[model samples]
Target: EGTVYRQIPDLIFEADYKDRWIELQEAADPWKCTLPGELQEQMKPFQRLLFLKQIKEEKLITMLINFIQESLGQVFTEPPLFNLNEAFQDSTCTTPLIFVLSAGADPM
Candidate 1:
């Protein structure tokens, strides 16, 4: 009589592989339907539940567009032109004015 070892069935290995794949998917997209902690806490319970469900069902880009349009309406308005020379005239002014321009757009 020699040593006898139990061999694991291939099906068991396949099932374990599937389980690990599912776990990896869950780990990868942990924030799929989550809101920032403060915003979630501020929402009413029933509204929060519905919003969570709806956001999961909705296309992310669509939700982002709606949020930007509804929450940041002022961004669509024309920005006020600044008189840079007058703004920097104060000797005590230590703040820097930064310009964000599009490609090929001259700052001057």
Candidate 2:
């Protein structure tokens, strides 16, 4: 039989990294939050569990674009209007607004 395993990620991204997930995990209070007292006393095993995570769209977009803009200033800065309008894209630009992440399964 195949065994169940938990795959924990080293780094996770979110709109507010330190503020959200960490705070929520702390508040979970697994010690205080429990099954029935009797159920907790008994040892049980052999159940399968899975947690698949996907990106939060807006947050991920904001995070990545912030990174890009910081790295490369004026992404589409094409100067000189010497009949080269085709090669030159508008200097004006907007920060990246769309981000996509794919979620997948892992076997253990």
Q: Which candidate number would show the highest TM-score if scored against the true structure?
A: 1
The models' CA-based lDDT, in order, is: 0.45, 0.32
Best by lDDT: 1
lDDT of 2 by residue, 1-108 (tens): 221222123223434344544543443222222322222234232111111112233243333444344445446333545443533453335633333446674422
Ten-residue stretch with the least lDDT total in model 2: 45-54
In angstroms, the error of model 2 at 59 is: 2.0
lDDT of 2 at 69: 48
Whole-model lDDT, model 1: 0.45
* TM per prediction: 0.23, 0.20
Q: After superposition, how far is residue 48 of candidate 1 from its true place, in Å?
A: 27
Regions of model 2 farther than 4 Å from truth? 1-7, 10-53, 74-108
Model 1 misses residue 100 by how many Å?
2.5
Which parts of model 1 have CA positions greater than 4 angstroms off?
1-76, 90-93
- As for candidate 1, its clashing pairs are none
